[model samples]
Target: MCAVAAVLLASGASAQSGWGGGAFFNADVFRADREAWHEERLVVQRRFSAGAASLEGGTVSRNGFTDPFVATDLYARAGTRGYGNLRAQWAPEASGVPRLDLLAEAYAVVGTGWEASLGARHIVTASSAATLGTGSVAKYVGNWTVRARGVATLDETIAVSTSLSARYLFDGVGGLTAPFAEVTVGRGREPVVAAGGLEIRPSWVVNGRVQREVRSGFGVSASLGYIWDDSLTRWTGGLGVTGRF
Candidate 1:
């Protein structure tokens, strides 16, 4: 994806102002079989007065091969109290990764403390394709934010999941520190792997994450998660760093 990165940087340089970007890396290791998956991404974005555009290139390593992907995201204000986001991704020669993915969402701000969003996602692989619909509602109270999300498959085999999360943000010395916990339930498809192949048959999941901005334009985050089902159970932990310029 080196050529993709060069193109993204060239486009970012053309932005008149409010240009910034970041890099991120994450890895997940399954406890049961000791298999690991790694992902790394570089992003560049330009923020306009009312909208933003970003391009990201990333690689996913799993099994014994790596797949490179490129994604573009666009965010814009819909009206005084609403916004929309659209994202698309392409990974041509990928088996574990989706060859084509598209997502679109619209968010509405309700009064002062509530927000709601509706979205849909379509993913295509070499063997199969699926479309999913999602909706979420979030409430902000004091320094705490609570959100509930639901997802359902739109294809023939019906699967659904619901998740609830709460996050607390603290104004620390450098910038902001946030910690969050989430719980999801129901028989649904999750983006996880088993036996070197992507599997989507998980019953429930629990996740916790903490992020801290240690200095100006630099941040660190760590996460722990557990996935459970009838035949599989595994724990995953990951650490990430991000820098903005």
Candidate 2:
């Protein structure tokens, strides 16, 4: 939950990868974790025709929590008929062993507009326990694209959740302007979360969302968005930058 930004790495036939900077704000999450609840990150990522990998690290800070912590995460995705991803995070410790978490998932396209995935999340702590998770996603792409996803974990750590999203891309703008929105519901203790945002491309990059352009080679892009959940009445916004080189 440190960063769910660009959660879906590849969709359809195209892939997106580059170097970027990002920030995430978890409202009242400070109360839950007690330390390093808010994070700022610098990331380097690469996405090939059939696979993707990324490395990110930064400072996780929160008040009255554990000390300001330095954390790094590694993510990988690959496959053909289906795809798989591995995500790992580590919070370095000065004295003892590092605090770490790992998650891995495999997904495959089932039909014309459907993909199913199964995953597990592990907390490598003293007890070293793991949570089994499963999810399915469906997507339709054309003039307007739409997607829906549902996920649930065996353990309560990651509650059962579902989300529906849609977006319109401006063909006239070189597919640069995209307006999108998503609604998410959490089954257990977590509240429903929603977000509405726009992606605008200036130069060769998009400043609001993640989508590969019609034509690709190299470009610079930026993204900004606001999120709202039942738990936080106030809107929380985030910013990100990506450049291909």
TM-scores for all candidates: the values are 0.79, 0.59
- What lDDT tens digits, residue by residue, belong to model 1 across residues 99-189? 8888887888776778888999887776777788989887767555677888877777677778887755554111111222233333456
lDDT of 2 by residue, 181-221 (tens): 33332222221211111111111111134433233332333
Best by TM-score: 1
Worst 10 residues of 1 by lDDT: 3-12
CA-lDDT, candidates in order: 0.63, 0.42
Q: Pick the candidate with the highest lDDT.
A: 1
